[model samples]
Target: MTRHTLSVKSLRTTMADRRAARRSRQSLERQLASYTSESDRIELDAILSRHSGAEANELRSIINRQAMDRLIRTGA
Candidate 1:
């Protein structure tokens, strides 16, 4: 390919990758918005820090369940 064509293709690929990343971040933000409590949000951040591979939805569900379990155990 010509140098000009190669540059154009490279720019297009970079832009597409950036757009995909932005969309992924927006989706994650929406999922995280489900956790309205401060403690749950803090727990989520801790969980995310420790479990880097976990998705927001899955981790949120786990944190919510764990919080519920704690509440039940304490009878509060």
Candidate 2:
């Protein structure tokens, strides 16, 4: 597989992992109900948000590079 393929696969996995973590955190929040402290929820949200954002940026970079490659190959 191309390195690009590997990167996209990795990005997909990272996104999946981020989804699972956020879901788990949300479930925890629901379970806590009136018992949840604000700090704990904020921490969980922050962690997931950072990871998801980084993965998205990486994917965007990869996609842009691929697009540029196509343009150059076509002499455009």
Candidate 3:
């Protein structure tokens, strides 16, 4: 492939990745909002805003685990 074609392909992949990430983040935020109190949601949003990349991923993982635990306990 030509250099220009390669660059275009890379850009398209990057854009798609970003869109997927955004959707995932929004879904996680909605899950948190549904499960957390208003104060806790606010605090969580603040923490998310302060972190990005791997730190953010770790936070999301922790939140997901807690959410799963709650669901299991409630049989939901």
What TM-score fits each model? 0.58, 0.45, 0.50
Candidate 2 Cα outliers beyond 4 Å, as residue runs: 34-76
Candidate 1 residue lDDT tens string, 1-56:
99999999999999999999889877765675577577877876786777645475
Which of candidates 1 and 3 is the stronger one according to TM-score? 1
Task: Give RMSD to native, each candidate.
Answer: 10.0, 17.5, 9.2
Model 3, range 1-76, lDDT digits (tens) per residue? 9999999999999999999998997786666646565477568768887888986876777676776777798997
Model 2: lDDT to the true structure: 0.62
Q: How far does residue 75 in candidate 2 sit from its true spot (Å)?
A: 64
Model 2, range 6-75, lDDT digits (tens) per residue? 9999999999999998898567544544323447546544655566676555444544455566568889
Total clashes in model 1, counting residue pairs 3 or more apart in sequence or in different chains = 0
Model 3 lDDT on a 0 to 1 scale: 0.77
